[model samples]
Target: MLSLRTRGKSGIYYIRGSVSLNRQTIDVKEFSTGTSDKDAASHVMAQYQMQLHNELLFGPTAKVADVTFSPEM
Candidate 1:
């Protein structure tokens, strides 16, 4: 998976992901924010949302995230 911002004043954003299956590749592309500098939180949230949506829409069954955080990390 890769995410990047567009050049110049476009302020456009792009996201790319690829999965290989059955000796073939399936690619997914999406855009969220325009070419702008995104804070870390926004970028993370964007990726999280995309993954969740893709799972619900394309997978056999959607699984919710069970996230855990620790100070020791």
Candidate 2:
């Protein structure tokens, strides 16, 4: 159950949602800046994706991995 919302004033996107995998809860929180609702949604989605990749070690994220893909690739 992922949820996305925009801040009332700053119009920043926020993702304070949860995901269940194998009975495990992965609660993610992320934020981004934008004006329109669509932009805010996209911002949250992008932030969440970055979090997943970096923290959860998804793929080609920011970490010291034994193997990594080329940045250009």
CA lDDT of each prediction against the hidden true structure = 0.54, 0.59
How high is each candidate's TM-score? 0.39, 0.46
Model 1 reaches what TM-score against the true structure? 0.39
Candidate 1: the clashing residue pairs are: 11-34, 11-35, 12-34, 12-35
C-alpha displacement of 24 in model 2, angstroms?
Answer: 1.2
TM-score for candidate 2: 0.46
Evaluated against the true structure, the overall lDDT of model 1 is 0.54
Worst 10 residues of 1 by lDDT: 59-68
The Cα error of candidate 2 at residue 28, in Å, is 2.3
- Residues 1-73 of candidate 2: C-alpha lDDT, one tens digit per residue: 6666777776656666675545456676654444447765776676665555454444344445434577875
Q: Which stretches of candidate 2 lie over 4 Å from their true place?
A: 33-40, 43-73
Q: How many residue pairs clash in each candidate?
A: 4, 0
